[model samples]
Target chain A: MEKSLVINPDKCTGCLQCEMACSYENEGVFNPAKSRIKVFTFHQEGRFVPYTCTQCSEAWCQQACPVDAISLNLVTGAKEVNESSCVGCKVCTISCPFGTINYNQSSGKVIKCDLCGGDPKCASACPTQAITYVDADQTGLDKMRQWATQTDNATSNTASNA
Target chain B: MHYIIIGAGPSGVIASENIRKLDQNAQITLIKGHKEPPYSRMAIPYFLEEKITEDGTHIRHKSNSFNEQGITLVNELVSEVKTKDNTLVLSDGSELVYDKLLVSTGAIATSPPIEGINSNHVYNCWTLEDARNIAKKAIPGSSLVLMGAGFIGCIILESLLKRGVNLTVVEMGDRMVPRMMDESAGGLLKSWCESKGVRILTSEQVISISEAKAKPLQVNLKNSDPLSADLVICATGVKSNTGFLESSDIKLDQGILVNEFLQTNIENVYASGDVAQGLDFSDQSWSIQAIQPTAVEHGRIAAINMVENNSCVHHGSINMNILDTMGLISTSFGQWMGVEGGEESVLLDEQNFRYLNLQFKGEHLVGISSLGHTQHIGVVRGLIRGKVKLGVWKERLMNDPTRLMEAYIANI
Candidate 1:
């Protein structure tokens, strides 16, 4: 099964360590502007959403890319930009529904979260477990188990059709 | 099989790589018009701003990437193509033959005809050579006069501002990026730049430029006072580099003519990138969408047809341009200039520098131009490109365009 980055925005602290780790891992820099993953702070609601590419199965970015620069990683299920193939057109950046893919002015290329080539640095760098790299097929397993534990096992509330 | 790809720009290089992947035993030779190692022209601004090194402008970082993949890199210009002989005649008096050919020569920066415009201080920021020359003199406190404020000019303007130069942008058009953005949108950008301390002169013409030995040159404008500047950069526009093809049998219209398959009139000969006049999906028109993404799409579509024996067909391309001027983001998509008999909706907030304009034909959204509101940039394009039926959402959008995300989710 392909691995994926499962994000729980509620656990996010907005410390921005993930942003630093991402930029350093991919761009060899500590600049937050260069980070593929971004943390959006909703000041009024006191909430923070750490967002990046969701690696959609039918990704519009991969389909809309003119040069086919975006490709699906079989192991990580992350969409990777072949920098050499990308023309810095910003089409894929605009095509993505999440707006996670962004154009890097320094490199003149669009960048998105590539899950750090299977071992994502953002997940390891997160102190609050807000971002986790896990098996994609079982991402809902934990939620299903939680709901299962809350069920009233001893009560049968079914109506009989006599 | 042998493949001869002309022009080492993104389109040609990507096509060559894709072709090689499909057919490993095929002989591939990529001919570049310049000496650079497949560097991106888009990265030149970053190089000018000192954000990236010269090496960083190169698309591939690996050493001898082409050679390792058995793709020959020929740094030479194709002076002529003998279609009947199935061969290419290079400028160095060499002949190369191939089973398939791709022309992706891209474009050349156009210099307006003016007196002493070719002086030492004048430059065109379209190539690596131009970037290197401008970076040396675009220093802090240096006075620079930039001609034209179109797409390329606006991008270079941002870099020049970062260099701390006293920049003056003179545009012949009434507003900046006249071709890309509408009047109000371009006007807003001009004000935004002016607030950032850059001087903008619109609806103006540069009469003449007199060269100087080592001092500042005199730049005379038609409707303004004469000014002296340390350097003058021309960002007038670009034309397709299809001059060599003038003698060839290929059909040309502003650019080389290609069908939906991206094939030229001649069989086994294809064209992509800025040099090809492909389809515009917005209205099924034939035009040169010279932007980088269009070039990439043309390259991939052409490569698929070449490898699959003309089995693949292109669905056409949408004209899209996204510009980040200083910190402000502006975008235009599809028929942004508006189609005939189309209903239009606009929302402008000059104080906040936020604007959105949507064009509609019946229930389908056709064109969009926006500035500052970038949260859901994809929805407009998706709805327009997908040609999704809006239904009641159209009425809701006509009321307020900010509900684009809600519309996209409900429709798609």
Candidate 2:
């Protein structure tokens, strides 16, 4: 199975280290604005959601790209934007549900998280473990395991009553 | 086979690349009018904002990319083409012969006729040279006045804002992006930009600009008071570079007319990008689609037919445009402007500033326009391009247009 970048928003501290690392990794710059992965802050709710491209199965950005500028990486499961092919139309930026794919005006191309060509810098740079790269099929395993633990307690109570 | 491509813009470059890909031994020559590398005109705004260096605008990143692919790059402006002889005369007193020719000279920004419009401070954000001039003068806090509020103007607005200019936009139309959006959508966008601290003047025209020495130029408006600005940008519009072909025997109507195969009237000669008036998918009519996607598609199809003897056929180009202004997103696809006798469904949320307009010609969606609704926007393009049979979902969509995602899922 291909690997995916799993984001845990609850653990996000909004330190923006992942953004810095991501920009540095991909662009050789430390500017957060250049980073593909973004962290959204809900000040009133006191929540920070670190978000990036999910490398969606359907991949609207890939489909909407008229020139086939976007392609799927089989190994990483990341929707990669081919800079050579991209024409900076900004259509994919609109098609992206999460708005993860963006037009880079400087390069005249659409840019998104490519999972660092298989090794995501955002996952490693995250200090709070807010982001991690794991098996795509098992992305829901952690949540499933949490619910399974609650079932165990319920089962014990019924056994004791019997 | 010697293949010559005029205009080293995205279309010409892409076509040349494809031609070389199809036949490795073929002689490919790219004629660029400018001295710099082939760059996208869309990147000029970002360049003005200093978001990227000039070199970043290059379509190809690798050094000597053309030479690496064995494509010869010539720097010369093509003055004339002899279709019968399949030869072109360059401005530098040189002639080149080609077996097949692709004219993709693109377009030039139109400078509105106004007094002092040619002043040193006045600029158009069209080419890399124009971007350089604007960047050099558009210093932080410098007073800048933009002359148009169409799609291109709005795009440049964001970059100018990021540069911290005391920006003001003057539009002759009632609302911004008058060509792309309806009143409600354009109005919401105007308000959104106003909230973001952009001064907008609608239904106004710049009567004239007075040249001054060592002082801000005076900008006289049709309705409002005169304003002073250090720089004036003319985002008015663009005209195709077909003026050069007036002497040629090839057909011209606003732009170089091309058939569905992107072939011009003359045999073995073609045009693409802003220079070509290609077919519109919504209606079987020819129109100039100056957008980048259409240009790229035109280039690919033109190249394939040029090299492989009709290996590919171009159906038509969908009129599509998406603009991001100061973080506000707006999109228009196909015939965003409703056709005659078309049934329309509109969902307008004025409070939240979200709007959706869908135009249906019978069971198929011919056009769609939206604001602030980013998710699944591409589905509209899919539905329109695929011409999917919506069946009962068409009626359901007419009742509730927000079920677009559902309809797309069930149909496409």
Candidate 3:
């Protein structure tokens, strides 16, 4: 089964380990600005949300690429940007509704999450288990189990009352 | 079903691939007016900048991507579309029939009527061939004069400057990017480019181009002294490539008229890309948004309707333009030009080269134009596109327009 990166924002602790790992793995640096995955800090809400490319099957960034520089990595299910082919017109950055894909000024190419070619560093670097590599078909399994356990306790409490 | 898609542009190529994905047995044929393999015109500037080769501009990295998808590629100019018979006449006197058709011929750059404008030294930088010729002439230390300072002109400005050419830009408008930017923003851009060593002539018209003995060409201006240059590039404007459909029954206004499904008046016929003027999101009016994102969306939506007949409806596209002039980045979204009675909040730091203008329609953010500010900027688009109601945040934003990301996070 194809694996995917599943993110649980509730488990996040505002630590930027994922961003550093992503940048170090992909760009050979520890700069958060150069990282493909970004952790947005909601100061007022005191919540940190880690966001990156969702790797949509019908990706807007892939379609918006004028030179077909963005292509699917069948093994990783990641939309990889071919640096040699990309003309860096910045159209993909605009087409992406989530705004995960961004242009790199140094290389004149757009950068996005490629799941580290199937060995994602961000998920492994996430200390809080907020980001995980799970089965593509079962990304919501953990959430479903949590809900099921809650409902089971509620049902047992009613039965005891009866 | 036999699907014929005219024009091998981004719209046509994407639609063909999508049609094949939806219906495996459908026969998809993509026709092209140019001899080159399916390539993107937007990448031509990079080609002129020597950043990418000709092969890098191909829409599909694999040359046989079309063939692999079982789509036929034809190089022929479409003469006419016979809607009644579901047939098309090619320029080579060949007639082809299709069960469904999509016209996405895109647009062609227009040149102003000036003497010697069609000369060998002058080019329009619109096609790969034009890029090839420009690459040869726009050499280091060469003198080049570029006409027009609109969106297209500004886009190629960096490329031309990168070639180490002594560049001069002439614009008829008082400021650069007149259509996209307000006077303040445009004027700031003009100063920015001027500071970067580009001789920009505003409120000037190119009277004519004449061959001179001292230089390869002499560019005469209506109000200023004539300038000599080795080459001249006209980035004036572009018009839809709808000439072939003049005799056909396909309706044409500013472009081919299509409904919400991107289908033409004739059943089973559709249009997309620069050739289609469908719907606008901001005003809910029909207009041609000749941008790449819209073209890609149109292609996918049009293909879906073609395969699954009226299964999808286009929600219209926003008018957006992002331009990188020299190192400065500027973006405009939705109705950048404020509507009547709409309030506007502007923050201009001319000395720092940072500018932001937000146009608000009541409590909703309708439009935005910004320069040098790029953090979480996508939220600006989301706020305008989602039509988020700002309520009290409107006053907060008016007082501090830089708090857009905060307003977007709270409201959207």
Candidate 4:
């Protein structure tokens, strides 16, 4: 029943509005440089992708944080970072495979997406539903349905063709 | 020793976070030159209208969370980088070693070359500090001379007019945003700004800026008349912040040259934000741009690539910018269609501020420019993504941007 942010690259306008929203929600400023969610742009291809920590069930950042600052929220399944306990060693940054954990040299700590403590404004602020907070377990439902419809599109061969 | 980010702007910040999720043990350090925490560079103007506070635009009010994640944050201007030795010399004569580096120094606003352009009242609205300095002098009834009539300049004019500043906009080009949008769009925007109590003068060439403090400062233009001003804001254009890279071997034309991975010629060194530029992933090897989204995406891709064990994913940035003038959404994506993509056609809705121009090399949607709010941008975006059959949606796209949703396909 856990909710997660869904990103539809097709809908992304490459505006970085979601990034600003993320930074504002967590950092109290509109700096996209501090946002947890990111949107990638492929200029020549005219494509944009919004990316962030998927908040995996088996979270690597939670396990790698030696100072015990990284923990998971039971209610929302978010891998939250405890700022007070962090040592700024950046061990969790390397242990996690996706590169979602990062260090802020100004405060000497790591930062990432916490899903805005559950509501995730990135989904709400998106003018286009490129980023949406959806059911974590059924995250693949959209992709599955698209593929399912394609299965119905391919034409069956007639017996005479053999 | 896992990642070394050169700039603390949006791209470096987001990329570092992305890398951390993949590898928690990696050490990530972001170096920023600005005195305050990273804030939205675009929202600096909104702050002028008191729409948001200094704290309101801050990108990271809380850096402790990163400290908990074991990331190091450095707040100093990087003077030099020894990629040969993998070290960075800081402003305070300190040095930090790195296994990898990502640069997102961002772009610098173009300063008009007019004599005494550096005078007290001359303004540039690129940074928070710049905006703050301009705000101090923008008192009610102040006569302001705005140089340039582009998007930022236009927004500044609109925002300041609301404060009752007697404003005048001067542009060297025939129209605003001439480099990006066509003359048609620029003319439309100029007329729109004029309707809001701002004087618009095109084809203006600046000769000098002198002291006229007793009244308003005189902006002597190459044209017959001079623009008078108590305050002057320049929004001519922006140049990539690659002057420092001149000392290094990194390639630079208009900006720092990088590849699809956002990596520079110097190994283990990557750049993004304003200072970095590279070939477009979808077009010619022309310089990409200094836009924010592209920069952040470049940082993420570069961070992933810098981590060798699990090769991080990276992508290139196509030039795209959307202008939100408070509520009026002006979207410009892909090529102008008329510029590089080939023959172009148009669907104009002057009454609705909606104009959809379709550029095609026959059947593909190579470029599109929607002048007004059209929800079907998603569909247009999909076609631009190189999905099949752009012609199928041209008639429909002309009708509505929302139809793009129905035009989308899993494969396309």
TM-score (chain B only), all candidates: 0.97, 0.97, 0.97, 0.91
lDDT of 4 by residue, B1-412 (tens): 6577766666666667766765678888877787777665655655787755776555444657567667677888888877788888888999989888787777778886669788877878988888888888888888888888776776566468767788887888898767556766666666666666678888977789887757658888887687678888888888877666667667777778777666778877877666777655346465746554455446545656666532533334445555544234455555654555366666666555565666665556556665664332433433554334665555554555444444443233
Note the DockQ of each predicted structure.
0.10, 0.06, 0.21, 0.04
Docking class of 1: incorrect
Give candidate 4's error at residue B205 in angstroms: 2.0
| Tens digit of per-residue lDDT, candidate 1, span B219-329 | 889999977899999999999999999899999999999998899999999999999999988888989988766776677677777877776666677788887787677
The best candidate by lDDT is 3
lDDT of 3 at B205: 97
Which stretches in model 4 have alpha-carbon errors above 4 Å?
Answer: A3-140, A144-162, B309-315, B339-343, B374-378, B395-406, B409-412
Most TM-score-accurate candidate: 3
Assess the local accuracy of residue A18 in candidate 3 as a C-alpha lDDT between 0 and 100.
Answer: 97
Alpha-carbon runs more than 4 Å astray in model 3 = A141-162, B390-396, B403-412
Instruction: Please identify which of the two predictions, 1 or 3, would achieve the higher lDDT against the true structure.
Output: 3
Taken in order, the candidates have interface RMSDs of 15.5, 17.2, 12.9, 17.7
Which candidate leads in DockQ? 3
| Candidate order (DockQ) | 3, 1, 2, 4
Assess the local accuracy of residue B153 in candidate 2 as a C-alpha lDDT between 0 and 100: 94
- Sliding window of 10 residues with minimal summed lDDT for model 4 chain B: B373-382
Query: How much is the lDDT of residue B103 in candidate 3?
Result: 97
Clashing pairs in 3: none
lDDT of 4: 0.65
> By the DockQ metric, which is better: model 1 or model 4?
1
In candidate 2, position A83 carries an lDDT of 77
TM-score for each predicted model, relative to the true structure: 0.82, 0.78, 0.92, 0.72
